[model samples]
Target: MPISLSRKFQQWVSAKLDLPEDVIMDIPRITMIGHLHLYIENHSGLLSFSPEEIRVLLKHNHGQMIIKGKDFVIKTILPEELLLEGTIEMVKFIKE
Candidate 1:
């Protein structure tokens, strides 16, 4: 399939202006601080959350982000962002 005109335009603008593609493309941006904090922006959904695991869905069919850890807690959650606190052991991305 060919890229849509609007998406092409967005890419062009992002490159020309040095803008973040994540903001323009609705892709997820993940941030981790040490082994205790996880921040995610532009997440599409929260599939599952548990004390030992977390599963987040990404937008535009980007698939899922799996977080394996212990003593997990949700520090923050918004329409497009999530903040987690835990003893993060592993982080993995599974593309759909």
Candidate 2:
């Protein structure tokens, strides 16, 4: 379940950030820039993110995570699909 940035996503990010394609697509142990926090999924499946939460569907019980911050905002949300924006203060991963 190694998470990989799609080619289209890579191109978009590279152009937007003026970064090399390889740099933008590199798998990071942990990625945080400005208010964005991204975690690479080790297993492939549906992934969800929010300003204050993250949910990853696994083979077992649903995994739930919480982010703490007052100004957190979900810039976009399509049901389980979402894009989070805010000053990330904390990140917690849970399995259950």
- The most accurate candidate by lDDT is 1
Query: Ten residues in a row with the worst lDDT in model 2?
Result: 37-46
TM-score of each: 0.86, 0.40
lDDT accuracy of residue 71 in candidate 2: 54
- What would the per-residue lDDT of candidate 2 be over residues 3-90, giving only the tens digit for each residue? 3346577778889989865355532223456656444332223355544555444322325555565455655544334345667777
lDDT per residue for candidate 1 within 15-68, as digits (tens), equals: 999999997898789889999999999898899999999999998888999999
Give residue 25's error in model 1 in angstroms.
Answer: 1.1
Error of 1 at 74 (Å): 0.8
lDDT of each structure?
0.93, 0.51
The residue-level lDDT of candidate 1 at 65 comes to: 97
